[model samples]
Target: MILTAFLTAAVLVASGGTATAAAPGTVAASDREVQFVSDGVPAYGTLHVPAHRAGARVPAALLIPGSGPTNRDGDEPPTVTPGTLKLLANALDQDGVATLRFDKYGTGRTGLGGLDPAALDLPTFTRQAVAAEQTLAKQPEVDRDEVSIVGHSEGGLQAMLVARRVRVKSLVLLAPQDLRLLDLLKIQLDAQVTAADQTALSKVITDFRAGRELDYTGMSTQLATFLQQAIFSPVNTRFVRSDDAVYPPSVARPGPRVLLTCGTQDTQVPCWTTSPLAAALRTLPRPLPVDHFQHAPGTRVNDQVLDPSVVTALRTFLEHR
Candidate 1:
């Protein structure tokens, strides 16, 4: 479920300090360290703002990370090599857009984010996102009403959740998933199981639904461990029950602007599964304004976030009228 743009991290300072925001042609640190409390847990974030220009305030976005141990930059390495989000933040700053990217539970300085990993739940992430959004909105450099939520992978799904609950300016979903939590898991796991082990895996899913013990008698130790920790873990059941989280129709209405990006080669949350997020926006009850771009030339992604195409496309999308 580590489904973000399979991306990477930030260039935040070790403690609260300021950095020079880069000129478009330059690559500067571009951010300030900020703090927000989620569910009473202290969460730290990197706030990327345009260089203070004549006391101007720019639109802000909350950059949310995907699942597992993804850092503020969208990376959970060994599985990814900093593809999408971190670069996107820098690109946005150059465009005069401010952004806030937070470290999720069990990651970076937030390390546990004041929540025990063993007792974590999906709400923890949602709370963190919302809290971070609220925190960003309070910044004097931000236009509160224009604060948007940009989520990659699972972060995209989380963005949908935030949109429905909060009155935000827009949404940006990067390789956002369309399937229900458990169903997506089933498909992904099925790909790994052999025809010989199909029955056993099927039984495991059945048992999980029925709240029975998982019997991994003949399964490889690695696979079994994966199933136990990632799939059947008690910490994630609430999400499994959310029924595909939010779908396209749900996101179609009541938002300022929505940009959905798809990387043609994204295998984890294949951009094709959801019938193009743009379609949902186009067919909305109110026919909302939408912008989307899929790398038609089939860009090869390093994880889900590192593609240069993602940064370029996003900069264009944000700059579009």
Candidate 2:
């Protein structure tokens, strides 16, 4: 079963490292290998179904990855091999909820012929997400009307766009940013620079805004390009303006049940940034329930750190609703 496999993996990971395994009661009941096709590209994922709900169709969640090359398990560059989503999926499975977590386009086992991160725009990602949703809806054990999406970070933006085009039942956003793409990137860069030199950081921001590439004598071309894209790309600017420009009143179609979460320590997308997003959603003149969950005892600016409690909250939300 999926839960059993996760327990086995947890035991192995815990025994081999300083990390603690999930408490016995927190493990899932079962899991299985599942795959789907998106735009002729084969996408792979794992479907964790609660053991108690065997033979019964259940509410389902599509787990969308954050930015970069994060795979189905939420692992990305500089942090390879961590199965964050897998662990979350297992925990949710224990609660009689099924989760489908897949790799972003051109990542993991998905075909890469037409995939290029640098060339990708918001709509491209949204289309892929919608395809993934439809694929999940067609599964025999998934209740189409009860299917929702749980997107983390940038994927949260993608989830919102996807919802506009699909009939998702609910949405859960984790540490989502409400700022325009360029502004968010500038904030992130400033934070990183402050760790070293405030003066240099300010200069770098000025240079970026002025369209001058920063000096990267010691940095690789890849890192340089990434920084450039983060700061100057029209893609990010457009995404931000488009999202902000949405007329909330026009989106009044019985909105999906929404849950927005952020960590107190999340530096990449700080609580302050996430608060505005939740506030904006609350302003929508619709009759939908919107909830916010800010992690207690929040850490300082390390959004990459995985908190098991977040997973618990997600499971509770999906199961009870």
RMSD of each: 6.2, 9.7
Q: Estimate each model's TM-score.
A: 0.78, 0.68
**Candidate 2: lDDT over CA atoms?**
0.58
Clash pairs for candidate 1: 5-304, 5-305, 6-304, 8-73, 83-305, 83-306, 84-305, 84-306, 106-112, 180-244
Model 1 Cα lDDT, one tens digit per residue, 1-321 = 421111111222335657765566543445678766533456677888776555567788888877777878766666664535676687677677888887776676677634444455565566667777777888777888788888876777788877776789888777666565666666666777776466677777677667787798777777788877776667655555443454544655545577766555555565446564556655221111111222333433343433456556567667752
Instruction: For residues 1-321, write the lDDT of model 2, one tens digit per residue.
Output: 000000000000001212223444443344555555544445556665554433567888888776656778776545454555666676666666777787665567553545443455555556667766777777677788889888876767767777888898888776654565556755776665433444444565566556576664444455457655653355354333343344322332337878777665566776666545665566321111111222234432224334556756676666558
- Look at candidate 2 and give me any clashing residue pairs: 2-30, 2-31, 265-299, 265-301, 267-301
